[model samples]
Target: MRRSSVATSFLLVSALGLTACSGGGSDGDDGARKAAEGLATALAAAAAPADGASTPSDPLAAVTWTGTDPATVAKEYAAVIDGMDGIAPSVEVAEVDGEADKPTATLTWTWPVVAGGDPWTYDTTVALADGDGWAVAWAPSIVEPSLADGETLDATTLLAERGEITGAGGEKLVTERPVVRIGIDRTKVTAAAAPASARALAELVDIEGAPFVKAVKAAGDKAFVEAITYRANDVPAAVRTGIDGIAGARQVTGEQALAPTRDFAAPILGRVGPVTAEMVEKDPDAYRPGDVAGVSGLQARYDEQLRGTTGRSVHAVPADGGEERELFLAEPAAGKPLALTLDRRLQTLAERVLGGVTPASALVAIRPSDGSILAAANGSGTGGQNYATFGQFAPGSTFKSVTSLALLRAGLTPQTQVQCTPTVTVNGKRFKNYSDYPSSAIGTIPLEEAIAQSCNTALIGARAKVKDGDLADAAASLGLGIDHDLGFPAYFGEVPPPASETEGAADLIGQGKVLASPMAMATVIASVQAGTTVVPHLVDGVDVSVPSEAEPLSAAEARQLKAMLRRVVTNGSGRGLADLPGGPVIAKTGTAEYADGGTIRTHAWMIAAQGDLAVAVFVQTGESGSRTAGPLLEEFLRAAR
Candidate 1:
């Protein structure tokens, strides 16, 4: 058993009066043992000084000092171990043994140095004598065997190298990159000049100056208040010259984890900087003030794996200019790399294609061959949200694919004729085709032609053939409406059973309570291209389990769905993709109307599968899918090819 159990049993025996000097020692020996145990308890409670809190005046108060003043000894002991992070150690009396005239006690001290690390354990002996009373003989070596009277322990931290985040083919995505920290160094200027200098620096950096001035005023006398950090190449020469002219302006070079460009997958990869107070409070042993840690996104999700162990070295420095000896050392460990399934080139191209789109747009690409997510790009208008995998909106006519599947399972083939009209009504609610529905394809036509032209009334007219849960079941087969943990932030969308007749009619056109994300729409195309259900994933080595209750998509059904979708590109709203260079492109186009603050808006959506690539493009506010989102999708597919 450990020393704590032994100490507890000893105290229990004494409390129960079960033992009386079993070795036949004198009363003085018992008194010495009791005094040593009391000293151990105080030592265990003596924490190191933190946040300017004063050290305990006497941790050995229970044991009277015979050879030295107790207060002076206590003060010296606190000074020597001041650098050990003020962690209270577990101290216990290991044993008490000696001649009757002079007794000695061995104390076990265990210091918890790091999280999940081996503790520093040691044993030291303190002698007891009868000078004025049963007291302990004080010496500097009682705390630590190697300590001298005037030596102090100095702790030095060794920083660990943060790991890189790698993409497909082992390409480094997030890695250490050079940067310049521009700030106001208060040590170089008077207190009155610091705020002015901060304002000037902020102006030169093109940042707001008032907040910088306020922060500089609140900082310490010699603190360096950082205003901004810029990539080494991004800093302008004019800014550098202006900084040199300022009295307190300074620029410090450093390295930080960064992507290829400023907005390249920023919302997903996250960033790292100084550790916050909340992080320290959450895990005091793992974090401290001034430490750099991950703050958001995947960087925060796998922080421990990315931020390796920090090494430490404790040295005994002599006060009389003697040689210092190392008491302990722990070597720093480098963090492991986080692997992802994204293709860097494809992701860059996707972001570039969506660069001009406004109002929360997203483009997601998945490889149907293996279900690997190749790209998930958010447009500049997203306001820092990861809209590619999380944006929820009506999918519009793109959801007709699910309706087609439900009808196919209802014994309707691709060539089966369905009535195509200008408008259809359900329960006094009128549903009609898009504004520019071609007059050539409007009468009675095959199911494939109705899908190609995106006939809303045609699908709503046939909704009576399928039952209540048919849409949800068909959506599950196409990889929608089922949630899976893909080891990252994602929204798989919702497809519920229709609650009323109007809602059921609206379901046929992908509106009225139907919601889907760009990633979810991309997965639907990937599933059709794969001839089976496909689950998209980004992080490598993460297991994903698809729901077992949903009916699996058969190869025959996928083939029939692909045939109808191909006709969509050949003659329907998806005609924009007809001239692409890639081998056959199967696609669907959607334009769903929504009310935003009493003003009507439409969500433009386009999804297509070309060769092994499945892509989905969505524009929150657009006129039509073929006109707004179709061009961007074509550009990305052309570049990717």
Candidate 2:
């Protein structure tokens, strides 16, 4: 049995050794011996020092870290390693007891022996296997505490403060405060009761006719909750009672109610439209869909200061649908109001005086001292048409002022002789005076008399002696070709340089496209009277820091021009104005013919200045200047005086 056992054991060993060499499993004793030999070889290789390098004196060394908390350092290290390409080693953190302000902790990690992948592990001490023993590298000092539940990580940003606006008299024009507007729905109530609501509303409100009707119709059959018809800035106590008394009518106020006045100064004060998509895309903060903007006149020019900042408020309501209550409220910002240089009284007078005239008349009045527009009115079948600053008409004999100025600048005095005849021929074209009748043999008439009588033949002959360019220049100097910048849309009447001799002759007579506005004519007269050219302005004291100055003209020339104009009123075609009660008034009249082929439709015109007031009037399709515009101007001048 012993022999068999020995043989069998030898066979087993042989088989294990074959298996081990051929990549097969081995017996226990043989495997143990081979593993022991491999371990010895590895130990010897690790213990040996590198070539030309000395061995460490303290092989099994320990290290202590003394800096920030161990957990923080570990987290930072992990974050840094995660950002790197290779795998990170494992690390362990241990807490150390301390006060909240000063934390304490420890961390331990092992440098792994494997060559591939992550080569580190966690242990009691931060150690690395070096030859036959372990070596501690670093030990952390403290542990970081976890962050609390609710803490802010960033801050909120605030907006800039808005600017303020005030009137010329230092009155607050706009403010950023809350306001209420009360309106009534007439459709919901009986027509018999409409007068009651109107009376009540009129007590504290100004009703808008067209908009009110539209709003009521828009509200439809809704009763006890009807939409507001008119908007008021602030709801007065009396008005609120009236509004509440009418069922379905309510109050609608706020920034939305500040729609600009559209029809009040139409053409002069332009209309506003809804915010465009382009506006919002360019500046998301500045404009929104329903925002009110100024389109023309003083409103457009001072839009920046007039429009105040807008604010928002948040209200807290019961989630369970209990009584609605206020939590916190933010006051709304309001816009500033504007006070214009326009004299309302004079404006009314002008309108009333012109009302009875033909449906195509216009009038303008200006203060020569400061250029403040005192009154501007127009006549059209419809009340909204603006002709004073917009309508363009032939100047007729009024343009003789420019011709006279040109003649004076060219050394021709008022006494200079010019032939007056029934007809004169120039460039194959015939020019005639107002009538074909004969006159006295006084072949030569003074310039003043020629202008007073509006003698087209004499004036046209005299114009031949003046330089062509100089006449054009004089017309420009008198504000004929220049555009009017009144903060609103305006037309610069055409005063083209004469292209042909016939055209030149026609131009001398204020025909052939010598068009002007009544306002421009008034400005020309004002300049001649005041000895200075003044730019018309509708707002006073707009800039406290920078005041406007007048453009000067020759005083002697102004006197001569004034004398001629006075002669027109005292003894000429404009003589009808001489009988007025006020002091002597200087005036001129014009009657221009229609261009269309028919019986000439006359454009009656008059310009007069008395004391500090200066006025200009034009009536279209009238028989004559003295018959139409003269009477209207007389009434206005009387009121002004």
Each model's lDDT: 0.82, 0.55
Report each candidate's C-alpha RMSD, comma-separated, in the order given: 5.4, 23.5
Worst lDDT run of 10 residues, candidate 1, spans 15-24
Report the C-alpha lDDT of model 1 over 51-85, residue by residue, as the tens digit. Answer: 33232344445346666765676677677766564
Best by TM-score: 1
Model 1, global lDDT: 0.82
**Tens digits of per-residue lDDT for model 2, 1-641:** 00112322232233222211111122333332232222222212222223343322221111112333334433433332221112122223332222223222234332222222132333232222121121112222111111111211111111113333332244333333344545555445765565455444544455545544443444323222222323344455666676666543557654332222223334454433334456655654465433455545444566555555443322222334455433223343555555555565676677778767656777889887776677777665435666787778887877787778877878878887878777888877998877522365226888888878878888788765777577666665555556645554445466787788777887887787688888778877776777666566665544311112222357777888888888988767788888888777888777788855766676778888887777889887776677778888988988787
Clashing pairs in 1: 48-86
TM-score of 2: 0.59
Best-fitting candidate, measured by lDDT? 1
Model 1: per-residue Cα lDDT at residue 326: 89
